[model samples]
Target: MQITVIGAGAWGTALAIAASRQPHAHRVVLHARDAAQAQAMQQMRRNERYLPGIDLPAALTITSGPLDALLPSARAEDLFIIATPMAGLRSTLQALQGVPASVAWLCKGFEAGTGLMPHEVQAQVAPQLHAGALNGPSFAQEVARTQPTALVAASPHASVREALVQAFHGSALRVYANDDIVGVEVGGAVKNVLAIATGLCDGLDLGLNARAALITRGLAEMTRLGVALGAKAETFMGLSGLGDLVLTATGDLSRNRQVGLLLAKGLSLEQAVTSLGHVAEGVYSARTVHQRASQLGVDMPITEAVVALLDGRLKAFDAVQVLMGRGPRGEAV
Candidate 1:
């Protein structure tokens, strides 16, 4: 099968490498946005800037050509993985409007201005296309190294899910099929925001009890917003939900967690963001998450607090206090 992965960021590169490493000889192409970067990766056989220390497999083709260059390869039997961030999903889908292939994205956040999830954006931009999302707890670096990882291939359409499974699922990587795209996308997106909160909790030297409590409640917030958005409540307990939240909140390699750690250390938001040199989806999508929750009349206290903190209206220490100061209420999911 021919596979084209658009957007050559760390996650995109990792997935391209993984696909190329599959036991079967499937043709795979990794597309970078910049022509120079594409040439560099092709020549050096490594994605040094984003995925340093990982060798690109000989079987993976690297390209920085125009979007039209991908059209010829977009057959019904092939898959186009939009590996761009949430912000680029719309334009990428727009570019692939007429392609006859299953499309999936690696991004896990709402669009910044429109506050749309990846599938929502796809619906608006290219509703005729068969699309879905591949998401779970796995990190780009870990997956690039061929570490064991399990992910959910979520789509209302069975073909998109099956294409994802056929193209990538293998001995070291497991892909589960899920029909709940809304639930999976919600879990994938909200976990980043919750990870920021967890990072702040840990950065403040809060004990294990605090961390556990915050994570449990954070999962509640996620589930609330997800169910309000038409997702299955039980999906929150699955890989894309509980598994992803725990991994992002606690993983040392999480960019969103690193943002909170830097902020807790007295670095300004700008300073922390600039230091990371990559998009931390939590910082960009916290407000949107809060907005969506408010629009849905869902109580997302943690998301509201995160929005406040990200907006510079509240300090990190005060943010914690605000969360703890909320009126005591009965525990509910």
Candidate 2:
């Protein structure tokens, strides 16, 4: 199988390396938008800016060029993975229009202004394409190092799911198939926002008991919003839902978690984001998540607090107080 990953961020490069190292020797290409970055990776055999310590497999092809020129040779059996950020998904899909390859995205957030999920953007830009999402708890650095990780391949189309499994499932990577694209996407997007809340809880010197309670309640918020948006309630208990939420909310490598930690330390939001040098999706998506949930009549108190925290409307302590001050209700999810 021929797999083309159309971005050279940490996650994109990592997956390309994994696919290239497969025993069957599938052809893998990692495309970068910057010509210099592509040239540097090709010559050095490493993605220095992204996966600094990991070496790219000799079998992996690194390339850069116009999207149109590069994709003309794409065949129906080929697979294209868009590894760009959520903001880039629409333009990338527009460029991939009419391509025969099965497509998937690695971005895990809603588009800022439009508030559209990745699948929704794809539907508007390239509905004819066979597409899905590959998401889970795995971090890019760990995946590039060949650590054990599991992800879900979610799509309404069977061919998209099968294509992702064939391209990525391997010794260190387990890919599970699910047809719940709505659930999978809701899980992926909302978890980042929840992770910010968890980070704040930890940074405030809250006990593990608080951490555990926050995560459990956060999962309930995610499930309620997802179900309102046409997703299965049970999907929240699965990898893309609970698994990804726990990992991002607790893992030190999580950028969203880092944002909350920084905020708890009294750093301005700009300072925190600048210090990390990476996109913390939760910071950007929290308000949108809150908006969607409110529109759907779903109660997402944690998400609301996160949005307030991110927007400077509430201090970290005050946000916690607001959540803790909610009116009593029967325990349910």
lDDT of 1 by residue, 1-333 (tens): 789999999999999999999998789999999999999999999999999999999999998878997797567988999999888888999999899999999999989888898889988989999999999999999999989999999999999999999998998899999999999999999999999988888898987898899899999999999999999999999999999999999998999999888888888899999999999999998988998898899999888988888889999999999999989899988
TM-scores, one per candidate = 0.99, 0.99
Q: What is each predicted model's overall lDDT from 0 to 1?
A: 0.92, 0.92
How far residue 58's Cα lies from its native spot in candidate 1, in Å, is 0.6
Please state every model's RMSD to the true fold in angstroms.
0.8, 0.8
Error of 2 at 165 (Å): 0.5
Off by over 4 Å in 1: none
By TM-score, how accurate is candidate 1? Answer: 0.99
Give the per-residue lDDT digits (tens) of candidate 2, residues 94-165: 999899999999999888988889999999999999999999998999999989999999999999999999
Model 1 C-alpha RMSD to native: 0.8
